[model samples]
Target: MRISELKKKGLESLKGKWGKAVSLMLLLFLINVILPYIVEVIGSGGFVQWFDQEGTPLWSDIFGTVLSIVLIPLTIATTWFYLDLVRKGNPEITEVFAIYKDGKTSLKLIGGSILQAIFIFLWSLLLIIPGIIKSIAYSQLFFLLRDHPQYTILEAITESRKRMNGLKWKYFLMNLSFIGWGFLCLFTVGIGLLWLIPYIGTTLAAFYDELIVLQEDEQPIEG
Candidate 1:
């Protein structure tokens, strides 16, 4: 699909489901605010000083590794929640987590994330620009697998590469739209961006869903 058409569909999808979208955005905000502390408390004994005196043991490293593992599923849960709001019209946060109750979907999301991270890391060795380019290139990957659960990691990565071709500028510009807000958050010590993060995330989710999820031969349904 053309960039213009994709953006139009994203806007239409947002307008058509404004209420659920708002609720989803709110739930997302709440989670983003609370989850970091929750994870820290659960993982870190609730205080930075908890680690200050420790020279760092294997157990602590193991604990941190396990925590990182746990975050993959949790992150997928949030991404799934947002995508459900966009595609299935379901606004329920609980239900989004519940979809991965079977655990398969969450695994896919985690695996995709790991692979994307690997790609980003390898690309970064060339220069920071390549890393950023790869990050944006594969940004839609989670959304793609969330919608099409059958996609393998290789398939999703290949498809992402294909969809990103010739549209790097478009994706960069779309992400650039949020740079001001992101910078504001950075300047304010990141508290300001918490709420806006989920909204912009879901909106961008809607953007990719509208623009690139469909098969190359398929046309988007009229809004």
Candidate 2:
């Protein structure tokens, strides 16, 4: 629960398992590229058609709608994948996909993703600050779900809320702390940005695991 301890552990995990972290980032990038491109092609005018068209194509709009539907689940899978690496120190890039390979996990990711998306989107309407707060607030929901797959969605969400209490500011600062790394990456003309995403992501994942995950079977008892 100590932020300093979490930050230290995250740094250590990053130093020890950077290669796998990088691979995960690469996979995410590839997926980001492919899904949009694929969707564009499936659109009425085709991927390139939108560029020349006066207005957006019907297909493009449809693609956007469909993507909205799929994005949540993908987000969940990525969250779990990254956290697994952090928690176990065993970096398996495929763990994310492995979860999706099963129908139940896939559905769970989709459900959680959609719900979070809506929550985040609503929070954003209050102003940008609330949006960021919501992001950090819901950030650990995926990790909770990953660790306790048996729990209902509502249960996992409630746990995230509890753990995040009085610590949202701390989590936000931790997240903000990555901005320097991001800026450094940008200074390299985005060459470093590619690596930065994975590096920062794994580091954050490590931070969450160390600070929030319970290693013992029994809950900590009050004095």
- What lDDT is reached at residue 166 by model 2? 71
Over 4 Å off, model 1: 1-58, 186-189, 214-223
Q: Distance (Å) between predicted and true CA of 135, model 2?
A: 3.6
Taken over the whole model, the C-alpha lDDT of each candidate is: 0.65, 0.68
Clashes counted in candidate 2 amount to: 0
Say which candidate scores most in TM-score. Answer: 2
lDDT of 1 at 117: 94
lDDT of 1: 0.65
Give the per-residue lDDT of model 2 (tens digit) for 1-223. 5655666665565665677767766666666666676666666456466566677667667776776666556656665656655666574766666665678877887787777778889999999989887877777777777777876666666677666667788887777777887878777976676666655666667766666664324442221
- lDDT tens string, model 1, 95-135? 65575576776677677778889999999999999999888
Candidate 2: worst 10 consecutive residues by lDDT? 214-223
Best by lDDT: 2
